[model samples]
Target chain A: MKFTILINEGPYQHQAADSAYQFAKAALEKGHEIFRVFFYNDAVNNATRLAIPPQDDRNITVQWAELAEQNNLDMVVCIAAAQRRGMLDDDERDRQGKDASNIHPAFRISGLGQLVEGGIQSDRLITFGD
Target chain B: MAMLHIVNKSVFERGTLDSCLKSSLSGSSILFIEDAVVSAVNNTAVSDKIKAELSSKNFYVLTPDLNARGFTDADLIEGIKGVDYAGFVDLVADNSNVQSWL
Candidate 1:
């Protein structure tokens, strides 16, 4: 079974981000293919390199990065959501002439079409968020 | 025909989830998002067979929903599966019909 994650809650806000992490790791253990991980709405915050979680709590930004590294999953941030949240990629950063690009590797800005596709290509499509 | 069934409510609030999926006609995707993912792992009022039929039709359950709820794929209810945004796009691309069940 191929797996895909649609995270709607931002990483810092709540359990949505962490829950996605646990599921991704489990899918791999089950021998299921992790096709992609999509962050939408506020959940796109997980892809932003600028997030700074308190040292007391979990480092969700880094956690997501580690999850991507372990699973080799495609972490996608909805372009619309990212822009709304002001998470600009290198190209967008350059175009906007921003000083730095905070987006991490293994994550890219994409469109909602990816959500529709996740439903079609896989044997099943699972979604997470509030 | 397929529907992207989104249980976006924070928690499994009574009949909201059942209402969400039941309200949707057949051949639709039921995504338990946010706190909705708990619906997939919890003991559902609906029968397992019915849920299985839903998945057999290729109805999808997005994975991140489960994760957000602190669940992993192994903890998912029987017959429920996961799909990311890319795969989600493929779902809409493959199927010509999509009605969002909120």
Candidate 2:
């Protein structure tokens, strides 16, 4: 089965991100395809590379980046949400004349239409939120 | 395919329920869970909106959540069904996707 995962909360602040990551990992391990992982609301924070956690804590952003790298996952951060939360890729930063871009390379900024497309293309769309 | 939309916050507290209603496709199912159970009550400010949607969408309130919040079936708006956890699972299985408005 092809599944699309939606995450609606920022990392560490809520368990939604962790649960979504675990579900995505389990689905991949079970030999199921993950069509896309759509980050919306505060979840767009997960795609930022500037987040730094203490040495004792798990780095959620790194985990997602590594998972995406290993699986060649299509991890998308909603552009509207990302912009609102100050998460920007190089193109967005350049377009908006921002001084810096914090978005990790593993994730791409896209429109909400990608989320609608995920629902249309995937067999199941599972949402994890606050 | 139809979607199962879950609203976990009170309509009085947030616009999650309204957004869920607006985003829901025709023939989708809406389930009120957690604090959202408050919206199932009769005569609330949003009751008219809920009643209006009933003609096109299926409405359900989690029985445990309703009870936890000190509400009962009699407190619910007409056409709203109170369901158990098992029913929640069944609704998820019956729908093609799950969209939680948090």
Candidate 3:
């Protein structure tokens, strides 16, 4: 089966990010194809590389990056939401005249069009949010 | 087509479960995850309502979320089933589409 994931909340503060990650990993382990993982609303925070979780706790951001790298997943952060929350990739940072880019390399900032495309292209679009 | 309706909020905290139950059609699958697992317990305020709907729609709760909340499968309502992350994936794959009640 082909699936798309939609995450709407940030890491640590909510369980949505962790649950989405677990679901995505389980799906991939089951031999299902993940079309894309779309980060919307506060979920764009998951792509920020600056978050440093406690040593005893799970680093949700790194978990996502590693999962995406292992599965060759398309992790897209919504450009509008990313802009609202000040999440920036190198290109977006340059475009917005920002001094630094915080977005993790595993995630690329894109538009809602990619989300719609994922919904259309996949068999299921599962959302994990608050 | 049978849709998979996922609820991630607690019924005690939000009306998401109520709205999902009301809007979901018969034959659909309802999977409670995260805080929503609290609703799957046998003797809550909303238990009767959920029990009544059991015959109409399938009900499931995520096991890890329940365990995180210090709940066990024995705490689940008679008709509701508990599933792990792999089962969660199967639910999505088996259903026609997913409607997450946030």
Number of the top candidate by TM-score?
A: 3
State the DockQ of every prediction: 0.10, 0.20, 0.94
| Candidate 3 runs further than 4 Å off | none
Scored by DockQ, the top model is: 3
RMSD in Å for candidate 3, one decimal?
0.9
lDDT of each: 0.67, 0.88, 0.94
Rank by DockQ (best first) = 3, 2, 1
Estimate, for each residue in B1-102, the C-alpha lDDT of model 3 and write its tens digit: 699999988899999999999999999999999999999999888899999999999999999999999999999999899999999999998888899998
Residue lDDT tens for model 2, B1-102:
688999878899999998999999879999987678999999989899999999999999988779978989889999999987556655665787787887
lDDT of 1 by residue, A38-83 (tens): 8888887787777676889888878878877876778888988888
Residue A1 of model 3: what lDDT? 90
Clashes of each: 51, 0, 0
Docking class of 1: incorrect
Ranking by TM-score: 3, 2, 1
Candidate 1 overall lDDT versus native: 0.67
lDDT per residue for candidate 2 within A1-130, as digits (tens), equals 7888889999998767875786687677767788999999999999889888999998999999999999999999999999988999999999999999999999999999999999999888878888
Off by over 4 Å in 2: B1-96, B99-101
